[model samples]
Target: MQSTYQTAALNDDYYYSDILYSPYQTLPPVIQDTLLDRQRIIVIANNPSITQAKLEALLQPTDMLVLFNDFIHAEFFAYHPSAKDLPKLLFFRQNGDSLLHFGLPPRSNNLTAILEMTKHATLGMLFGNTDYQFPLPSDDPRPNDDPITANRVLEIPKPLDKLLRSQEHCGVLSEQHSVVADYPVFADIHSSAPTSGFLLYRLLLAACLEVQQQKNADTPISIVMLGFNNENKTANFWEGHNWAFERQELATPPHGVEIIRQY
Candidate 1:
C-alpha cells in the first residue's frame, strides 16, 4: 500500500538560514534503530521564527509528517501574534481517494481526514505552538501585551482537538493557562520570555519519552526541529557531553509541571 505522506518544496516567498538534523550517530541506539527500522519521522515548527528553507529540507526525507503553525491557527484563539508576513510550509499526502492538504487550517471535515491519516503510522510528531508566549509589538495597543493570562484557555479547532484527543500517548508543555488535558502534562513553562527553539526541544523530548513507553523496543521516533539556529541551546544540548538516552531533568519555568518517565 502507498504511504499517507510525502514531501514537497517550500513556497518561494519563504526565507531561511539553514537546515540541521540530529546526526544519526548522535542519537541513542534505540532512537537510531527506530528511525532506520520503522521510518517514522516527526517535523515540528514550534514558532514562526523558522525559515521556509529549513522546513522543506526536513520534509525531503520523510513520508510521515507533522507540522505546527500557531500563526495560521491564531484566529481560533484571541491572542497569538500576527504571522501575516510569514511564509507557510505547504505539502500534500494521498489519503484514500483524496489528497490530504496541509499548511492551512483544515475545514471541519478535514479533522476526520487527519485522524484517518494517523491510523497507519507508528510514530507521530506535533508541530506549531507549544504554549510559549511571544513578546507583543512595542507600539501595539493591547492593554496587556502578555496574552498568556488574557488568552489562557483557547478552544482549539474541532479537527485538531479531536486529533490530539485520539492519540494514545501525547505530551504537552505550555503556560499555566494553556491547557491540553488529553496527554501527559509535562513541564509548565508559564514565563512569557522563553524562545521557541527551547520549547520545541522540551516538547519533542517529552513526546519521545511518551512514545518510548508505548511503542515496542524496535519502534523509532525521530523529531524534526524547524527554523533552528546552531546557537540555540537545544543544539548545544544535543551535542553536549552530558546528553544521554536516559531521561534528564529539564529546566522549566517557575511553577513548572513535572513528568515521571519509565526510561
Candidate 2:
C-alpha cells in the first residue's frame, strides 16, 4: 500500500492563480524553454530518502535535472554524488542560512561544490531574496565560470515571495492552517509557505502547457520527483514548513507530476 505522502500525483483539481503564482509568465525564456522542451524532468530535492540506487533506476540521459538551494552544499553532493554533474538548472535560496554555501573563502569546500554544481548546468537562478548582494563564490575562479550564471542573476519570482509571505493563504490552498485543519499554526511566523520544490513544480507544469499551446501540438513532458519527504516536516505551532498541508497536496498532486516512492 502507498503511504499517503507517497501516493501517486494524479489530480484534476490543480489550481493556479494570483499574479504572483505560476503562470506568472515572466520567467526567463531560457528557463521556460528548457523545461518545456524536455520529455522528462527529474527534480531531486533535499529529502534524505533519495539514494543513488533509486535515481539510477529512474534517471535518463535525456532527462533534465532540477535541484534546489543546497545544490552547492558538499554534504548534499556527498549524499547524492550522481547529481554532481547537473546539466540543466539550479534554484537556490538567498536567505542568510543558505549563504554559507556561497559566502566562505575559495579554499574551503565552497569552490569545488560551486564548480561541480555549475560547470555543467546552463543556468543557476536565485529563488529567495536578502538585503545583501547575490553571492557568486565561483567568481574568484573566474575563468571557470559558466556564462549563464556568471553574468546574470535572476530575481525571486514575485509569486514566490507573495506566496510565502502571504498571511491570507496556506501554500497551494488559501485557507489558513487553523481553518484548514483542527490544528494551530502561528500565522505570522508559521504560516504555510509552499516549499521551493512545490513552487518549481507548478512553474514547470504551467510552462510546458504554454509551450504546447504555442506549438499547437502536444509535447509530452512530465516532472518526476525523488526524496521529497514532507513527513519529516510537521506543522505544529513550533514547526514552520507546513508539513501537514504540503504532504496533503503532494499526496494528490495534479497530472504531469509523479512522486517516485520506494517500492
Candidate 3:
C-alpha cells in the first residue's frame, strides 16, 4: 500500500482539507528507522544565505540531510556549489510539494537532479503535503509562476482520505495530522500554523526524541536547522498562520535542535 506522503503530492479542492489539524504517529516508520541509523539529521531550509560550504562542514557521510521545496532547482545548486561533490550522505527529500505525477516522460533534469540528490535520498524522497502560504512566489519549474503554478504544484492532498495506502518509503503525512500525533502540545500551541518545515521539524524531532529516550545519549543524535527565518518574509502572509508563534518556537529551539541563523 502507498504511504501518506506518496499520495501527498499535488492537490485541489478545499472541502476535503484537514483544516490545519495534525496528529502524529511515530514519525513515519522509515523516518523513525532513519533516526536510529544516522548520527545527525540536518534539515535545510531555502533561506539563500545558507550555502553548501556551510552544510558540508557540518555534514558527514553517515549523517542524513533533508531538503524540500525548490531545493532541486538550479538556485540551490548555485547556492550549494559543487553540491554534487558533497559527502556521500544518506538523505531524504521530504517534498515540500505534494506528489502529483507530472507525466512528461520523466525529464532527466528532474530525474537526474533526483539521482544526484544524495542518490535521490536513501530515504526514498518521501512525499507529503506541507502547508502552502498562498501568494508566495513558486520556485518550481513550470510554465508560469505564482497562483497558477503553485495551484498545479499539487493536485489536492486528500491525505486523511487515503492514509497508509503507499509504500513506507513514499509515505504521506497528514501535515498537521503528522504533527499533532506526537507533539500534540506543539501542534495545538497558540495557532502554530505555518508550512511543512514546522511539521517536518516536529516529525523528525519526535523520532529523534523517541530514540533518545532509549538512552542512546552515548552518541546522541543532533538536529541542525539551517536557512530558516523567524519572521514572515512574504508580502502577503497567509491568514491563521501565527508567524509570531512559529518564530517563538524556532527561537527557543526544541528537541535539541540547533538553529544556525544566516538571515
Using lDDT as the measure, the top candidate is: 2
lDDT (10s digit) by residue, model 1, range 1-263: 11111000012222112211222222223333444433433344334454444433434334333344332223311211222212122122111121121222221122323333333333232223231122123322332422333333333456445444433223222322111112222244222222333334343333343344445433325544433333344422422222221122222211112221111
Better lDDT candidate (2, 3): 2
lDDT, model 2, position 161:
32
- For residue 123, model 1's alpha carbon misses the true position, in angstroms, by 14
Q: How well does candidate 1 score on lDDT at residue 99?
A: 19
TM-score versus the correct structure, for each prediction = 0.31, 0.58, 0.58
Candidate 3 per-residue lDDT, tens place, 1-263, comes to 32232223111111123523322232445555655667776777756676655665766756666666445333343235434433222222322242321211111123224434434334333444432222112334442422343223332234411322334544545545544333323344443345556667666654554465555454347778877776667543655455555566667664357887764
lDDT of 2 by residue, 1-263 (tens): 32232221122232334544444243443455565556777877765556556665676655777666534334444335454444455554333233322222221223345444444444434334332233445444442432234323333344433432332221222222111232234477633354566656555655555555555554446778766754544222335445665577678655677887533
Clashing pairs in 2: 20-159
- lDDT values, one for every candidate: 0.30, 0.47, 0.46
Going through the candidates in the order shown, the clash numbers are: 5, 1, 30
Worst 10 residues of 1 by lDDT: 1-10
Ranking by lDDT: 2, 3, 1
lDDT of 1 at 192: 29
